[model samples]
Target: MTSNTILQNATETTISGDAQVINAGRDVNMVHGPPAGLSQLLRPVSNATYTRSGPVAKCDPGTRVEVINMIRNWLNRRDKQSVCWLNGPAGYGKSALSQTIAERYANKGRLLGSFFFLRGAGDRSHIARLIPTLAHQISISVPVTKRLIGRALEEDCTMLDSSASIVHQFQRLIANPLSSPLNLFSFFAKSKILVIDGLDECDDKVQMAEFIEMLIDMSQRDQLPCRIFLTSRVEEHIRKKFGDARAQSVLYCIDLAAFDARPDIQLYFEQEFGHIYDQNLPIMRRIPQPWPSSQALSVLLDKAGSSFMFAATLVRLVGEDSMPSKVLQEVLDSGSNGLDPLYKQVLSSASPTPAFHRVIGTIMILLTNQSIESLSLLLDIQAGEIVFELLKVQSIVKIPGDDNKPIMLYHTSLRDFLTTKS
Candidate 1:
C-alpha cells in the first residue's frame, strides 16, 4: 500500500474501523480536534462597548486630555516602564475613564485585556476567575491549566479551592502565558496594558491585596511584559497596600476628581435627550432646543460633583418626560435638599408593595458599592427580577449597560439619602 493509503488505513483503524465503514468509498479528511482542554480555553471573551452621552461635564477636558496623553505616551515610550493607579471617591468616573481608554486601545488592536471586578458578583472577586477572564480576552490558551480549571468546575468548586492558591494559579496559568516568546508581547518590548477596575469592590480584600503585591513583584522582576491600570475608590486597605512612596513613583496615580470634563457630560446629555426627543416627537415637529443652555448646564454641572454616574442619572431622569423645562425647574427648586426627594419620588412611583420600602432599605444597608449580585443572592432573588423592579425607577438607580452587575445609585446624594433614612 502507498504511504497515503497506509496513513488513511491507520486513521481508520484508530477509530476502530467505524470511519472506514461509514465512508466506504468517499475521501475522508482526518480531523484532529483542538488541543486537549482547548474547548474551554477557546470560549469567546467579552469586549462589550459601554456608551455614555452628555457634554462630558463630569470630567474636565484638559485633565482627561492629559490623562489620555499620559497613557498613550506610556504605551508608545521605550526604556520607560510605568503603571497607573486611578483613585477617586465612590460615584466618580474612574471606571468610565478606564473603559474609555480600554476602548481606545481596542480600536487599535493593542489592548491586552480588561477585567471589571463586581463585588458580590459570584467568583469575580477571586484571582482564579479574574486571571482566566483576562487570558480569554488575550486569546492565550493554556491547555493543562484549562484541564485543571475544568476539573475544579466538575467537582462544583469555588475558585478558592483548598487544592491550590489563586495567586499561584494566576502566576502559572495566566501571567506566564504572556511571557512566552510566541505571544504578542515578544513583538512589543513594552508590555500590553491590563485594566482592572473596582478593586475596592472585590470581596476578599486580603486576597486582592496579595494579588496586587504579586503583580508588582512580577512587574519588577520582568516575568512578563504587562503593565496594569487599576481603578477603585480609595479603600483604606488598598490605599495602605499601594501607597508606598517607592510604589507610587513606579505607578502613576491620577485622581479622577481632578478632571474637569463638564463639557463632555453636557454633550452626553444633549445627545441622549436629542435622540430621545427626535424619535418620540417626530410628529410634533418641534425643533430640538439647544439642551441645557450654558447657564442651565452650569447648574447641572454644579450638582454633578464630578461624578459621571450622577450626571448620567440626572439626565436620564429629567429626560424621561417631555417637560424638560418643568423637570429642570423642579430640580433647581429642590436645591441641595431636593436630590434625595427626587430619588424617593422615583422609587415610590415604581414600587408596588409597601414591602418595597423595606426592600429598598435592605439594599441600602447591604450596599458595598460593588456587584448587585451579592445583594440579590443575599435577598434570595434573581438579578433579573431585581433589575426589572429597579428599572421602573431608573431615575434613582442606574444599571450599567454592559454587564448584569448590580444597579448603582445615580449619585452619592441618593446613597446618602438611603443610608441616612435607614
Candidate 2:
C-alpha cells in the first residue's frame, strides 16, 4: 500500500473523465442510487453557485493580491500541513476571501467540497448537517466515495439519525467510506481541497470543537485526502481550540486582522461608487465629476476604519436610495461611532416601532430561517405590516422578493450589535 492509497483493488475501476467517474450514478434510474440516496440525507447551502444561485462575491479585481497568492502557494505546495485557518475579527472580509478560494479551486477540479455556515440560516447555522453535507458533496466530487458512503449508510441505517453522535456520523458518512482501498488509490493521487467558512456562526460550540478535533486528528494521521481551508471570527471557543501546540503543528493559521486593508477598501469604494455614479448618471450630473468630493470620500473612509461591513452597508444605502447624494450627506453628518453608532443611525432613520423591534429581534435570535409568513404567524402580526417595517431597514436586512425565501441579516455584526449589552 502506498502512503496515499491502498492498491489492492486498484484494477477494479479504470481512470476516466468526469462523465464516467466524477459524476457517476446521475444517469442511473434506480431510486436508491448512491447519488440519490446521499442527496436525501444532506442539506447544503442552496444558494451556492453550484446549486441554483449565482456566484458569490469574490475578492474584488486587483484586491487582496498578497493574501490570495499566499493561499494559492500553500495549495500548490507538497507539505505535511493539511489544514489552513484564516481567522480575523468581524468585517475583515474572511467570507469573501474564502468564497474566492473555493470558486477558484472548484473551477480547476481540485475542490472536494465547501460548506459556508450562516447564523439563523436553518441547517447552515448548526453542526447537524455538516458531515452529511460534506459527504454528499464528496460523493459527487469522487464517485467511488459516493458508492462507498451509500453502502456505509445502508449498513448502519442510523448514521444520520438525530440521536447519532458526531463521531458516529463522521465515521459512517466520511471516514469509513474514504478509508476504502479503492478510494485511497484513485482519488488520493493529488491533493483536493475542502473550504469551510464562518465556523463561528455554527450555534453549537461543543460540536464545533469536536469537529475541529476530528480534523486535527486526521491531519496528524495523514488521513485527510484533501487540504481544508477554514475561516471564522476569532471567537474564544474557536481561538482556544486552535491555540494548542499540537493543533498548531498540523494547521497553519493566518490572522487577517493583522493585515492592513486600506488599499483594498479604497479600491472597493472607488469601483462601487463609480458604478453607482454611472447608473445614476442623470442625477449624478448635478454633482461634481468625481461625484463624491475627495473630502467626503476621506471622511467616509475614516468612518469605515478597517471594516468592510461599514463600507458595504454605506454603499448599499447610497446606491439604493432615491437621492444618492442626500443619503451620502446623511451618512457623513451622522455622529455615531463605529458600527454601533451607524446601526443606531440606521435604526433611528427607520423610525423603529414596537413591531419593528419584535421583527428585527426575532430575526437576530431565530434558530432557523423564517419567511415573512412564518414570522407573522409566529408573532401574530400581519404579513403586510412586517413587510412595511422591514422596508425601512432594507440597508441591513435582506428581504427576498420571493416571500418563500428567508430574510437574513446582511452581516452577522448586525445581530451581534443588537444582542450586546449597551
TM-scores of all candidate predictions against the true structure:
0.70, 0.86
User: Which has the greatest lDDT?
Assistant: 2
Off by over 4 Å in 2: 1-36, 42-56, 184-190, 335-337
The lDDT of each candidate is: 0.59, 0.78
Runs in model 1 lying further than 4 Å from the true structure: 1-36, 39-63, 140-163, 182-191, 276-291, 337-345, 348-352, 358-391, 398-422
lDDT per residue for candidate 2 within 209-320, as digits (tens), equals 8888888888888776678899999888888788878897788888887787888888899899999999998888888868577888888888888787788888887888
Candidate 1 C-alpha lDDT tens digits along 201-310 = 67778777887776666655656456678888888878876785546546667777777767666666667656655665643245336644666667777776666666
The alpha-carbon lDDT assigned to residue 263 of candidate 2 equals 84
For model 2 the local lDDT of residue 294 reads 82
